[model samples]
Target: MSRSSRVVFYSLSRKFVQEKQAPPKAQEVIYYSLAIGHHLGVIDCLQSRLECPLDGFNRWVAQLPSGGAARRKLEGLGRFGEICIDSTHTHLLATALSKAAPLLTDEQQSWSQRLIDLLQLIENEPAIYLMVRRRDG
Candidate 1:
C-alpha cells in the first residue's frame, strides 16, 4: 500500500527530548512490518529505532496483565520490539495499554489517549497498516 494510505503513529523518543530538537520532516521515513488485522505491511517505528533493548522491552511487557499471552505470541514469532498483533490478539494489546497507561510518566501519558484511539481504530478496520515511527529530531 502507498504510504499516504496507511495509518501512521508518531512517537517522540527520549533522545529527541534530550536533544531539544524539532520533530523530523514529514519526508523522513523508517519502516518495519507489523501485521494488524489482515494488513501485512504496517511500519513499526519503535522496533526500527532499537530505542529500548529487547530485555527492557521484555521486562515492560512482563508487567502487563496480559503480558504472558503477549510474550508468548511475540516469542512465537521469534521477534522483539516489532508489534505484529492480529485481530485475535487486539484485545491483548489494548488491555496491556490500558493497564500501563496509568503507570506512565506524565509526559508519556500525554500520548496515551492517542494510542487508545488507534487501538479503537484497529478494532473497527478489517486491515490497517499502523506506522509507528519515533520522531527523533
Candidate 2:
C-alpha cells in the first residue's frame, strides 16, 4: 500500500472512533473489515514461528468483505487474503500486519493481541484459534 492509502485508512479508523453518533452501517463494516484484516496478519506471523498448517486461515478470509471492488481496494497489498489463501508468503504478510497493529484502539489492540498470544501458546487450543463471526448475514 502507498502512503496515501495508509493515510486514508488511518483517517477512516480515527473517524469511526470519533463519531458523535452511531456510524453508518457501511462505516461500521469498513472499520471491522480493516480491523480483522490487520489482526489476521498477526496470526499469520505466529503461524510461521510454529511451522504449522494454518488450516483455519481461508475460513477467515471467506468471512471478510468479498465484493470485488471493496476487496481489491482495501487489500491493495493483499495482506490478509494472500496469507489466508496461500501459506508460502507468510513472512512478508506478518511484517505488514505488525505495522498495522498500532493503528488499532486500546480495545481493538487488546482483542488483536489475544489472538497473537493464542497462536504463541505451546499446547494446541481449539478455542484460541476460533475466529469472531458477526451475527448479521
What Cα-based lDDT does every candidate model obtain? 0.43, 0.32
Could you give candidate 2's per-residue lDDT for residues 1-137 as a string of tens digits?
A: 22222111100102123335545765656555534654422122122221111222222223334553323332432344222212222233333334546555554444335434433331232222222211111
Measured by lDDT, the strongest candidate is 1
lDDT of 1 by residue, 1-137 (tens): 22232122433211112123335662132121122211433332332212333333344445555536754754442242234444576677667667777666553444445555655666787353243422222
What lDDT does model 2 reach? Answer: 0.32
The deviation in Å at residue 29 for candidate 1 is 32
Clashes of each: 1, 0
Q: Relative to the unseen true structure, what is the C-alpha lDDT of residue 59 in candidate 1, on a scale of 0 to 100?
A: 48
Q: Assess every candidate by TM-score.
A: 0.41, 0.26
